[model samples]
Target: MAKKTNKYIKPFKNIFVFILLMFVVWMLFFDANSWLIHHELNSDIEDLEAEKEFYKNEIIKDKKAIKELSTEEGVEKLAREKYYMKQENEEIFIIEYQDSLPKNKEK
Candidate 1:
C-alpha cells in the first residue's frame, strides 16, 4: 500500500509559509510590542481608570463635606456624631446592639 499524505501537508513544507508563521509567532510573543505586553498594558490602563474614577468620587464627596463643614451646624453635627461631644451641662448617651458589635471567633 502507498503511504498516505494529506493535501494540506504541502503548505507547511514550504519555506516561506514556515518563515511567515515564525514571524507571526515572534511578533505575537517575542517582539517589543507583543500581544502579552499589550494585554498587560491595557489591563493597567483599566485599573488606572478605575482608580481615577474612585479618586474623582472621593474628591466630590470631600468637596461636599468641606462645603457642609464650612457651616456651624455641620461642625456641630460632626462633633456630636464622631467625637460624641456634648454641650455644657448636657449629657450624652450611646446605645449598642449585640448584632452590631464585632463577633469573636474562638478556636
Candidate 2:
C-alpha cells in the first residue's frame, strides 16, 4: 500500500478551527443581522436620503412661490396665467396654431 498525503485537509482537522469557520460563515450569511442584510438596509437608507433632499429642494421652491404670491400682483398674475382669470371688463382669447396642438398617436 502507498501512503497518501493531502495538503488541503490539514487545517480542518483541528476541530476548533472548523467550528470557528462555520460560525463566521453563519454570521456573514445566515444570521438575522448578516452582511447581506446590512448591505440592503444601507441601500434603502441611501434611497430615502436622496428622496429627503429632493423634498427639501421642493419645499424651498414652494416657500419662494409663497413669498411671491404674498403680494396682490403676484396672486393676480398667477391666477391670470394659470387659471385664465381676467378682470370683469376684459375678455380672454386663446389661439392655437397647427403646431401648438397635441398630435394624435392613433394615426
Best by TM-score: 2
Per-candidate TM-score against the hidden true structure: 0.80, 0.89
For candidate 2, list the clashing residue pairs, or say none: none
CA lDDT of every candidate: 0.97, 0.96
Q: For model 1, how does the per-residue alpha-carbon lDDT over 1-107 read when each residue is reduced to its tens digit?
A: 99887899988889999999999999999999999999999999999999999999999999999999999999999999999999999999899999999999975
Task: Report the Cα lDDT for residue 60, model 1.
Answer: 100
Local lDDT at 106 for model 2: 100
**Candidate 2 per-residue lDDT over residues 1-107, each given as its tens digit:** 98776778888989999999999999999999999999999999999999999999999999999999999999999999999999999999988899999999996
Pairs with steric clashes in candidate 1? none
lDDT of 2 at 77: 95
**lDDT of candidate 2 at residue 88, scale 0 to 100:** 96
